[model samples]
Target chain A: MGKVVILGDKAINDGVSAHEEQVSNLDALHGLVNEDLKAVNRVILERMESPVALISQLAGHIIASGGKRLRPMLTLSTAKMCGYTGRRHIDLAACVEFIHTATLLHDDVVDESDLRRGNATANAVWGNKPSVLVGDFLFSRAFQLSVADGSLQVLDILANTSATLAEGEVMQLVTSNDTETSEDAYLEVITAKTAALFASACRLGGLVAERPSQEQDALASFGLNLGIAYQLVDDALDYSAAEKDLGKSIGDDFRDGKITLPVLLAFRRGSLQEREFWKRTMENGEQNENDFSLALNLITKHNSLDDSFDRARHYGSVAKDALGLFKDGPEKHALQDVVNFCINRAH
Target chain B: MGKVVILGDKAINDGVSAHEEQVSNLDALHGLVNEDLKAVNRVILERMESPVALISQLAGHIIASGGKRLRPMLTLSTAKMCGYTGRRHIDLAACVEFIHTATLLHDDVVDESDLRRGNATANAVWGNKPSVLVGDFLFSRAFQLSVADGSLQVLDILANTSATLAEGEVMQLVTSNDTETSEDAYLEVITAKTAALFASACRLGGLVAERPSQEQDALASFGLNLGIAYQLVDDALDYSAAEKDLGKSIGDDFRDGKITLPVLLAFRRGSLQEREFWKRTMENGEQNENDFSLALNLITKHNSLDDSFDRARHYGSVAKDALGLFKDGPEKHALQDVVNFCINRAH
Candidate 1:
């Protein structure tokens, strides 16, 4: 189930020694966690193998393409932090990943995206129809996974999160071409799209651990703040990232008419000429090379990227403070590392 | 909740009288059903109202296009037939309809269809992006509706049905061009795409009624057979119907490269000239005016349309037999009429 043997900072720095370090890090968590996590992984693999050949092929293509498994890690890490010894944590972990994956598949289709992680999107290769249907397949599979666990609270949290995720997506779609899109609206969209899953991950962990109500709240807050920070940094990177390292084109958001945080901030602070350019380009729902660079320039000149980074740091601080609710342990340290990783990851 | 009205056969023949009768029929279904159905309707309306202006506008437009409400009808009718006498059936009905509508929206997008039930498809009018997202919204809403019932069996049935439905869509996408699509595969597609939902409709009814497990299976069988029969008839109508009645062009499936039963049968039985024409035209996935006439000529020559209809009648008989497991009533008669109407309806 742990098909993701991620080669991140430690893997790059420590090479062969990193494997042992990874195993030791996992071992420091609950002993039962390994078995449950394996179950979750098995279920995801088994379910993703669709009888429909094309769907299975495309999903396998993407899942096999290395992702950090960050959402699942959050689920498992939060559960461990809350002293969860149960196996259902694995199901929750899978649920989190399924929701994230479904969004990615559909988002690619919606965006008409060609590249992701330096590879072809499902829609790019298989066509939008299969991608949409497979996204549906994964969504149903996720719910089935949750139902198998037979916990009402877990279902409620996951279900609500799913609704919130869709709402966020719809909101993003609406605001994509609106130059006047505000920070509040951007925050709402990000919170719904990204943070809801993160919050649900930790809250579901709390449920599995049978933690006190207050501790559950704390865990949820931790996840929400961490998710917000993660998204802000990711948004900021769209302008700053080199295609070779980031696996995406710079100013891709502007080219797509996506009014992300930096663009929204720039719109609020930039010159009249800059404002007119954004209004003309975004309001017309048209993009060209010139429009892309001009939009990027405004954001950079207004220091909106810096503002977004500061916000991400603020959220990272809040995420760290959330750890105070749990007992001191390696789980908390792992959670901290995850927060750091979220803000620092290049792709 | 019953926004649609069902006219009595007598009233349907009587023009103005039919209109009044239809209105009354809608009112009756709305009033007689428990509040559960109302709750489902409420959830559906609320959920479909996308924050994205374009999406919300299009969804409202499509839903307001006046569908027959057949899926929801089956759900409500089955629940009533089972003597459900509970509040949950409305939500289940709404859940099933939402799934159906979402699939319809996505199906239109995949098919690149312009007209559905004589109105412009959401995708055709608004664009694929909104259609796809709104479809997703409806799907999520359906899942939420199902979750509200808090029944594991309901969740399992709907979730599995969803996967089957999506698989059917994918299969349709893949096999539409392959002339070798067999009758068995065609049945498989309908069973997954159409019958599964219908069967679930009956099963939910049984569940709501608190009927014995044996009776539940019987109702499911009835619904599944009827649903398959309905689809066969619907497909047959594409060739057999007049444009004004079918609200689509004649030979629509052939034009769309959908290897339906009549065409498959005709390809099996036609003369070598006809076979060669089909092989070069339809099987080759190339259609033209001549191909249209050639397909019609073959259908007339081979009587495969009749053969397909005979198959539908066979399933309709099977559906009635399953209904014999229950006692007689107007509701029972209505259920029987549904099977008959499915086969006999013009569209």
Candidate 2:
């Protein structure tokens, strides 16, 4: 079982050193499932085919982009860890990736984001119309794939996760630019939008392996906590990571008036004048060149970044404990390594 | 059993009166399946609910709008025609409506449509972001409904239909603003986008009845041809129907550079100067106030509207023949009347 560690002012040094890993990438997890990962990539390429040229062109662009293929790999690795082998995981893994990709296409359009993975987003390259429609195409394609797999349970998980994904996105949309958004509400948004899919992906791997119900629940818990940690780090990175490592422009959240954790913390802890600055820039949408720097400075002075990292580290510990019942092996170790990689990115 | 009726220039008058109906609405179809229709409506109202008020707000606005629950009616009526007495049709019918409503939400965003059913569209009222996400939410909701229905066959149908719907929309995007688009290409777009769902909706009715594959095929064929005729009439109505009857602004297709059959025919049959006019207005998207009237005049000059209606009448006959194998009953008779009602809209 994992304990909640409330960090104090002096706990940042202890937390960072305790959670440090020599490697800051998913290479170990990928290596463990290297063969299965290749097979999953092949399935993605094969299934993304369409008679419509733009669909294939645009779908290929995003699928081939350097997205780390993290979600599908989770399914592949978790299925392997369960010690049951079948070919269904390959197709199901591809289906999971398809759902994720579909969400991305729509997400970029909703966010009006210009860059993803250091490349032009599909919405930016093609336009919102094609991105939206193609996203829809990919989403339906995933359902078709799952139907062919012929598992009512799989269909249930994917369908429920998809609705939650959209709900989360809508929740985020409603909360955006409202600096008064509560931490609970912000957590709800990320849990629904980001963590839901991650949890579903890992659970599906266990499902395909015909694992026991309790193990399925454990895998889901692992994924849910790990996903929360992953998104917390991602949100933190948007404000704190180097431009080259972030793969996107820094302060995009600031410019978009997004009410992320760091922003929420800074606003809650800011002086009267600083709170007005947040209200004008985030709520009223009045931002200038100096606003992002000031926002960043405020977040730093308030130790909001380190605090966010500490919170992610806590969730990471819970994710690891969710897998405590599984015996120590390559698959289990590799999965735990993924948790560290996600959290360590903030460094 | 249907013989294709290739109408000549002189065949317009003969086609119009033959397909005319005493009523111009779906009153008879509604009457036959009126009870099941009510049940389907209950399911829709109960299911579209969400904690997020805007999803319910936008979904309710469109669901309760006056657009004649035609697709779900197709499901209910067809299921009754097959003598299906189960409760599955209620939910599956609602599921079909959800898919259709989701498509409409996304379609408005893609077309940048301002008015639907003569009211401000969801996108128009709430902006594109919420509309897109809510559309995704409804799409997933439809899948969840089908999953609850617990039929892999039904899931396959809805999934395939969804992919085709999106593919058709993307094809339309590629073909839009091109005066050189062929009549075949235009038909391909509408058939995939509109007719695919209509086919699936009717097919699901037979499926829930546990009908034979042949009967399912017949229902699908009946729905497909009827759907094509429905869209053809819709396209013609866009050009020739009175503004009040059309429910949307006349010439929306023209303004959006949508290459429907009438526009394609008028463009191909026009003079070199007329071709350049289309280039400037439809392709280049340069239009003045008088241009719509000019375009209407050209369509009338070439009898494009009547010919388009004639084509719709032909498909209506094929749709009738698809239902010929079944014995005559209220469901059968009402279904046939729907074909006439669809074609006679141009009158």
Give residue B298's error in model 2 in angstroms: 1.0
lDDT of 1: 0.76
Measured by DockQ, the strongest candidate is 2
Highest lDDT among the candidates is held by which one?
Answer: 2
Q: How many collisions per candidate?
A: 2, 0
Model 1 has how many clashing residue pairs? 2
TM-scores for candidates 1 onward, in order: 0.90, 0.93
**Candidate 2 Cα misplacement greater than 4 A, ranges:** A1-25, A241-248, B1-25, B241-248
lDDT of 2 by residue, B129-160 (tens): 99899999999999999999999999999999
Model 1's CAPRI class is medium
The residue-level lDDT of candidate 2 at A208 comes to 90
Report fnat in order of the candidates. Answer: 0.56, 0.81
What is the CA-based DockQ of model 1? 0.60
- Please write out the lDDT profile of model 2 over residues A1-347, one tens digit for every residue: 01111123211211111332333246677677888888988988988899999999999999987576788888988999998589998898899999999999999999999988668899998999999999999999999999999999999999999999999999999999999999999999999999999999999989998988999999999999999999998888777744324244678788898899999999999999999999999999999888888888999999999999999999999999999978889899999988987786545
**What residue runs in model 1 are displaced by over 4 Å at the alpha carbon?**
A1-39, A241-248, A285-291, B1-43, B46-56, B241-248
